[model samples]
Target: MPRFAANLSMLYTELDFLDRFAAAARDGFQAVEFLFPYAFAPEELAARLHENQLQQVLFNAPPGDWDAGERGLACLPGREVEFRAGIHQALAFAQALTCSRIHVMAGVVPSNQRPEDCHSTYLENLRYAAAAAAWQGVQIMIEPINERDMPGYFLNRQAQAHALLDEIGSPHVMVQMDLYHLQVSEGDLASKIRRYLAGGRIGHIQVAGVPERHEPDVGELNYRYLFQLLDQLGYPAWIGCEYRPARGQRPHATSEGLGWLQAWL
Candidate 1:
């Protein structure tokens, strides 16, 4: 069976960020992921994971100033210095937590910038990140968020993600494929998995129900079949459960609402 990791950032909204670790474990999740971990001390977060026996499967590098609307700094033209610093900070946390993957978000393209210009900068920054991460034995992941959820985001399609990977030519850089985004932007999930996973391009995977982005069981896609497909292809990475609990099912009712994962387990 494919292993599943709870996305604490999106899943356990009812609890505080630090408390989500234990909540995930109590819900029968063995591993977990999140958007960012910079606010807390790496050692403190490590202690939580050790105490709960949970693995930190993945987390994103610090996206530049989220409230100011900076989704990521990697694609921004003049933030190369800030971007590199963020990578080091992420590595420090990953090392303390024993996490092996970090997804580097591509920032939204500014209205004044040309797509080609931004993409060129993105390639260079990813090249730097890949080399730095490879030295520390951590893989760099690039996720393509759908335009609907993150309009103007530089990376938004699987084909574009793979093509960029080919150009980067870094063995350590891989695709952080989010199924929800793929379904939104490009609907042929089965065909995409067959081509990408079979070829070993996918480094990590995240899933949620379509339209509502809730529990996978209620989604338009047959996630149960996809889970089987992961095993058939011998894809061994963790499948991050990056979704919200269905309405009225978060916080106090989390564990009971985990029926979908219970079925898989």
Candidate 2:
């Protein structure tokens, strides 16, 4: 069976961020993930996870200046220093939380910059991050977000992410495959999963409803079948529930919308 992790960043929006951990555990989720942990102290986040007996499966390295429309710094030419600093900070949190994976977002490509330059910078930065994380026994994850959702995002396809991993040539670095992005950008998801998962480069997996980004069962992709496929392929990793509740942010909306997960469980 595929282990599922609640993405606290998206789910449980009605509760405080710290309170979401207990809510997830109460809902029977054994693990959790989120976008960024930089807003809170590592000790505080760690305490919640310990209290809930929840494993912190994944989280992102800081995306530079989120308020200024900056999504990530990995692919930006002049932000290598900031990107590396963010990696160090992420690893520190990973250690405190006993988390083993960190997602590094490839920022939006600047209109004035060359794609080739961005590609080179992305490779260099990932290699550096992988090296830094390896010492901490943590792996660095690179996700290919869809351009529709994040226009001009540097990475946008599974093959593209795997090829970059090839160039980076570090076992500590791998792709963070999100099915929602895969369905939007490229629809041959089963083939992509088999191809990449078989190749041993997919470090983590995430799921959300297609088109609307709601609970997985609300999507057209048929996650029940995909969940079975994952088991058939022996994918032994956590699948992060990275989606919003279709129930909106009303009280208990996240829990009420967990029929999909409960059915599988």
Which has the greatest lDDT?
2
Q: Rate the local accuracy (lDDT) of all candidates.
A: 0.90, 0.94
In Å, residue 227's CA in model 1 sits off its true spot by 1.1
Tell me the number of clashing residue pairs for each predicted model.
Answer: 0, 0
Candidate 1 lDDT at 83 equals 96
Candidate 2 lDDT over 1-265, as tens digits, reads: 9899999999999999999999999999999999999999999999999999999999999999999999999999999999999999999999999999999999999999999999999999999999999999999999999999999999999888888888999999989999999999999999889888999988899999999999998968989999999999999999999999999899999999998888656
lDDT of 1 by residue, 1-265 (tens): 8899999888778878899899889878899999999889999999999999999999999999999989999899988999999999999889999999999999999998888889899999999999999978999999999999999999999999999999999999999989999999999998899999877879999999897888888779999898888889888889998887786445475565678788677
Best candidate, TM-score? 2
TM-score of 2: 0.99
Off by over 4 Å in 1: 248-250
